[model samples]
Target: MVRWNILPATCILNSCIINIYDEGDCIPPHIDHHNFVRPFCKVSFMSKSNILFGKQIDIVDLGEFRGVVEIPLPVGSVFILKGNMADVAKQCISGVRHRRVSVTFYKMDDSKAPYRFQPDPELEELLPYQL
Candidate 1:
């Protein structure tokens, strides 16, 4: 990610979570925890879908919801979240028609790391290209 300048040198992504979504599977709307650093990102794969963003996402029914805005998430694309988008607005993916996978990367606050968490030495001091 650093080589592509997707993330700056100051932001080291040390943690990741993989999400697998099956047909009819939906993700509830919520903001990322403060324990995780900002400027996080989710890379999509396998399928295309829409991500909803709003201050309040209302559940209309099982696998249904109402959001203020929607954004298309194409396969092999990266969605970066920072500032208010990471801390204020909530995001969710509605029930998908096909299997989908996403890998989310973020920097975890040192003080909030899990009890057994150990920082990976390889991810330290990641520097983006000078160009």
Candidate 2:
């Protein structure tokens, strides 16, 4: 949670939408920080494929050691989480090798996603390549 003074804060997310495909449409391994704002995120899963959610997330409601989070989500199964949790989920997602589309709904830090008032050449370069 460190912030710089001189360097203008970067617009991590902005009003951008990242949708990639892998034949089986597999996304890369990373966090959802560059999407929305706030310290939380949400995603809606829709597919008949064998969907799996990695990392051991202990749901207070469910008292069981769930392996990977495998969901047979029909068409609109919404999964929500806090910002930090979303980041962790992204890490788990990175290792997934399958065909699925993760429709994410979350926020970013610093500013509201694209908090950058203007343009940042450095972050701009890191933008295209980051996704």
Candidate 3:
């Protein structure tokens, strides 16, 4: 079971591991694809870094930065994006200062429902069935 204190009640249908190497590693501003559902979670590891978000983000070539907002993600922290925060704005991780790994978890869009909510035998045994 994947449990987070910040998001007490979340069901993760899928997950992916991301590796960031050194200061030069960066992901340009972009929104997640439609294959992913809203309210996804990213758990950071190794080092802390700042993630910039806005309608538009401009990354300077000299390692400096500019954006509407900067959200610091500390090691072992979970960052969630959903609704307006996920749809209306774009986000990017500026120059990574150190090696880091992130595990992102989210559900699939409802149109892909048949591929979602697969039953986990372990979780099913641990919890009561809902009506």
Candidate with maximal TM-score? 1
The local lDDT score (0 to 100) that residue 122 gets in candidate 3 is: 83
* Residue pairs in candidate 3 whose N, alpha carbon or C atoms collide under 3 angstroms: none
State every prediction's TM-score relative to the real structure: 0.87, 0.40, 0.73
Per-residue lDDT over 1-131 for candidate 1, one digit per residue giving the tens place of the 0 to 100 score: 76787987667787888999999999899888889887889999999999998999999889877899999999999998998888999999999999999999998888997899775677565654576
What lDDT would each prediction earn against the true structure? 0.88, 0.41, 0.74
Higher-lDDT candidate among 1 and 2? 1
Model 2 segments beyond 4 Å from truth? 1-22, 38-46, 49-68, 89-101, 110-131
| Model 3 residue-pair collision total | 0
lDDT of candidate 3 over 1-131, digit per residue (tens): 24434543554555455665575687778888767776787888898988888897886775545779999999998888888778888888877878877777777665665644685688656753344
Candidate 2, 1-131: lDDT as tens digits? 11322212342333434444344344333455544554332343434333335455333222222335555434455444444455555333322233455555433444443444676678666634322
- Give candidate 3 regions above 4 Å deviation: 1-10, 62-65, 113-131
Task: Please rank every candidate by TM-score, starting with the best.
Answer: 1, 3, 2
Query: What is residue 4's positional error in candidate 3, in angstroms?
Result: 5.2
Runs in model 1 deviating more than 4 A are: 120-131
Question: How many clashing pairs per prediction, in order?
Answer: 0, 13, 0
